[model samples]
Target: MCKEKIMNSESEKDIKISKRKTSYPINSELLDYLKSYDRAFKSPIVYDDLLRYVDNYPILDKDENDTFWQGVIYGPQEMSEIHQNLKKIYSRLTSDGADKSVDHLFVDSVDYCTFGNSHPFRIKIKNQFNDNHDYFYVKKADASRIYGLEIEYILSPNRINFLVFENTLVEEHISGIPGDVFIEKYLDEHTNKIRLAKEFVKFNERCFLRLLGDQRSYNFVIVLTPDFDEMQYRIRSIDFDQQCYEGKINLYKPQFFRENLDYVKFVTENLDESSIKQYQHEERALMAKRMIVGKSRLTKLLRVMKNDQIAPREKSFQLKTEIFELLKDNEVLKCETMGDIVEAVLNFILRNYQTSMTKLF
Candidate 1:
């Protein structure tokens, strides 16, 4: 298989996502779920508090290009108050809310970005003795995004570190090369294109399974690790605003996005359809194992999520039909909410895998 193998796949121009997505409120059920999982607590700084900034200056990357973020300015009196609380919030997210953990840390920068849906405030922290810095983000706590984070934490290999309060969400920064940059600057020089392609297939499958949408190249990240002999690659979703919110099925799959066409083509060139399918199965089996271990927590989440309204009725039904087209399972038709749809799909995978295992014996 090569370029012609995926001649009909999507390009960047084919997809037109909404310019802005509606932010769903975190209702009581979701709040309870977060609390039960230790993901929700009182925060010293709320998202609205950060909005009281006086002005902002555009931020630039090392190449002098706009980074789509701005350095927020605040009054000196208010700045000191906010920075101290922000340091406290960081300790909560990373150190289980210990007050003394942030004594040596200082808030280096409070940057704001209005380029996307969340309009998050990026906080940069530096150590007093050493210049080593770390990053975190404070954003409006949207319920849909919370579900995405929980699903990633429960199902994916990557762990999500975050905390949520009344209307604020604090998340540790996900460190990786921007996916677009890796595709352009590192792919040609990557040590193991085949392994990378396999991971792409698995990543694509994982996104589709969880109904996590809008995974364009720039929206996610590429994590490269040096194995003893070869390079291992991983694709991690950094943005979760679109989790189970879109109507179109393709939106859930990263391979269909125009920004990811290069990876799609590279995959076609290096791997056959059978190899792609094998990787997808491997990913599903791993997720199913995780589901078994996290069964109680996942069940609690699904119950809460099904009662929460994250998507419009029309969009939810549209997605149900589209998913049924591929999965051909009647359980999908029973879904009344976006959460129900997620549960159905996951149960479908888990049940099918369990059945096969039973038959093997």
Candidate 2:
């Protein structure tokens, strides 16, 4: 009986080892979980440090116009804490077999006064972080507000300050908002602004398909580089924590590019037809292929998410549904050229939406 029991225990051990070998790696496991839930798992360590710094900093008494004196830097006490988090992330990036240090991969210029509660910073890396360099959004976790994480990114590396603000253009309420009104409210005299916004939404649809969440307006910015005598606004994502989706889900659709017609009309009215066609082509070319995952891997991962007994909630659920209803006719996204995307990016900047309360009628 003792001999039989020993043999059975050995067999069980072998099965467990085999399972471990066949199971997904730890990094992939965590990434898959985030994708399944449509959530960006912000780093806890970074969030804690940011909180500590913000807590001790003395609020500035100056007026809002003095953006530079906002006292946005993290407090002195948080220096050590921030350092620790940076060290940890750096260690991971430069671990035994890692390709490069995070800093070497991207230039780091920090910012503390982001619109979001979390502190924001600029990351200037070459070769685009995973072919996503144009712009990416990332979140650092916190126990406080659910949207406690910060959203930020630079549109291009060659600019005055690559760290530009990305305004989500959506209202703060999170629910009961109309998408067209939001854009109209922020629409600018420049025709390019509307075109840029539309192109951005189209690009965003790609992100949604990958199971990445929180593609808020404030999460990214449009960059305009002066070429010869002309100016062009390009779209780029700043945050990247959610780029690697474990699931193989594709949410691409024509409506996503055309659902909000009012906003599109508002934007296109300011542009020439030639530019619009150009943006349409650029969007299509980018969406033609999925470069991030292999067929087998994507298939297996998406299946796991589908099989999991979980129901996910919308991250920006508080936004007014009435406004989003306007998202039903987004004609701007249908453009087939970079010109439309450029027009869209520029139009928003021209609108100067943050301080505008003007009557469009």
User: Model 1 scores what on Cα lDDT?
Assistant: 0.89
- Give per-residue CA lDDT, model 1, range 81-103, as digits (tens): 99999999888888877878889
Backbone clashes, each candidate: 2, 57
Q: For every model shown, what is its TM-score relative to the native structure?
A: 0.96, 0.38
Q: Can you give the lDDT of residue 164 in candidate 2?
A: 11
lDDT string, candidate 2, 1-361, tens digits: 1223222332232211011111112234434533443333223253333434353233343443423212334655565455444433433322432334434343232334454433443222233356423212222322111111111111212212111112111011112223433454535565366546455434444443232333333334455556685445544443333322111111111122233333334333444555544544444333322212133433444333333322112211211121124233233244222222222322332233322424543
Which pairs of residues collide in candidate 1?
11-258, 12-258
Best by TM-score: 1
Show where candidate 1 strays beyond 4 Å. 1-6, 10-13
Candidate number achieving the greatest lDDT relative to the actual structure: 1
Q: Each candidate's root-mean-square deviation in Å?
A: 1.8, 21.1
| Candidates' C-alpha lDDT | 0.89, 0.32
RMSD of 2: 21.1
